[model samples]
Target chain A: MKNQLTVILAILLFFGTAGFSFAVKPGEQLSDPKLEQRARTISKGLRCVVCQNQSIDDSDAELAGDMRKLVRERILAGDSDQQVKDFMVERYGNFVLMKPPLAVNTLGLWLSPVLFILIGVGLFWHVSRRKPQTKKPIDTDETEHRLEEVLNKMKKN
Target chain B: MKIQPIKFLPVIILLGIGIAFAFGLRNDPSKLASTMINKPWPDFTLERVIADQPAFSREDLHGKISLVNVFGSWCAACVQEHPMLMRLANREGVIIYGIDWRDTAEAGSAWLEKYGNPYRKVGLDANSRLAIDLGVTGAPETFLVDKNAQIRFKVVGPIDEKIWTEQLKPMIQLLQNET
Candidate 1:
């Protein structure tokens, strides 16, 4: 009973921390129109570093919220779109961007589909070319005759 | 041909490694990777705070190697990171600018007072518009802007002594050399 309770408590704690970790409530004040526009532009392409399949603008994760706020501040302070992207990249790497730029580190990510197609083709070729082992069609009479001949030949030899 | 146990061992090991790698990649919820550094800085103007006056604007950022910190009074991490910010502000050629994102003017001022006022300029992004422009999701993020107004480095989380000694300082040095 004690062990069961402990397990339940541990699970509760894990979920509680997870929920607390990332939850972006709407800001008390509406965001500035001009700055908001600029922030969105940068965020649309930035992946949520903390959440699966979410851009910073769409994510509620703490890190995503932080990234969004940072983008706004920089825009108001006077940063350009490229500059904002550059900033995110420096800290989080190219993976933070939804559209990762062409670079050596991301070659594997970019070429996966093409590589997978080639592998599929190679497997198909190997399967198709395999040697077929055909079974000989034998009648009962033929089998008996062959057996008699084999026995006579063995005796003669 | 007979199958060797040793050959199967190699295959099994390779399969295990492949499965482990795929699982590891999928398990990480955060896909953090550095994207763009060595890019131009975004441009904007903000109101700066001072003892007895109206707030200032982007003109103040001219001709300096500056660090732009997007933080807010409401952010817990901002409070946590204030001291490290103070240390960085004290360094030469390192101007710290604060963007009080999504906070009221009164609250923003109170936050600065409670913590140290290390920012050379404090811009009020009362409306979340400014943060949106910078692609900010939330607060306590930092960007390193060069003398030419290009962004050199960015630190997503709080800046600490370890980050300073290893990542930030080295980046600053690289920028220093480039210019």
Candidate 2:
């Protein structure tokens, strides 16, 4: 019984790891290992628009699967990686790319954070500079006179 | 006293962000903007879903305005839009082409038979290769193509009565007037 249980556990462990590691669907892989690797690299950077956040490489959506097939087909047709990416961009717009190119439309998206930080820093500097001007030392004589007045009032009470 | 002006900075920034969010919320996330707008439709020669029927190609789109609808037998949304497509075909008198995307030819033929075929020609995109080229991320997407084969506009989801009357009808009227 012990030996049988060990065999069953080992079989389950092997299948579990195999299933986990082989996430890419079968028949989607190219025969050429180098080309397949390139396809995977390209797919990892292509966003699955249907899922919105996951890459085509990670998504199980039917559209993502089709996109993965398209990437491989283009690569097999002798197009370069850049050409494949351009083809997708032309059809799906720049949204398909995981890392958007610095273009007219996306220029604002890439620079807004930096712009906000600069504005914040400038505001901070401006406010700090003005802070000291308004916060001058209180008149020591006035404070001492007030303290004496308070003490005298307390004695009377 | 000078710091009084600076006190409103955060509030101003927050108000700007709130306005931005309000505009963002007004946008419908389900409607994706098409990249193929104003671009020539991609060339393709797809086998007909019906065996004896002639195959479809980009050339068929010329000489008249056409609506190319991407659909699949497996897609539930396609079924919902089928009645609207039939109405468009009969009432509008415009050519309606079908791209049976990511579906079996037998299933596609059966679906058309059951739902009443609204398309003049049905192209089979068994592997969805041509559908991908057309920027079809899902089923039931419609594209309005001009006589020159340029895709003028696209609708991503089901084309209900509201979309047809409000958005597409006006666009089609304008396109019809052009040349």
Candidates' TM-scores? 0.56, 0.82
In candidate 2, which residue pairs get closer than 3 Å at backbone N, Cα or C atoms, i.e. clash? Answer: none
C-alpha lDDT score of every prediction, in listed order: 0.71, 0.88
Candidate 1 lDDT over B1-179, as tens digits, reads 88755446447757977997988778534323333356565556555444454553556556667788989888999889998898788764467888887677778888888887888778887655555445454567787877777667777768888988898877777777765
Model 2, residue B17: C-alpha shift (Å): 1.9
lDDT of 2 by residue, B1-179 (tens): 35786678889999999999999899975566788899898888798898889867888898788899999999999999998999999988868999999888899999999999999999999877888888888888999998799999899889999999998889888888877
Q: After superposition, how far is residue B170 of candidate 1 from its true place, in Å?
A: 4.4
Runs in model 2 lying further than 4 Å from the true structure = A1-23, A123-157, B1-3, B177-179
Interface RMSD (Å), each candidate? 6.2, 1.2
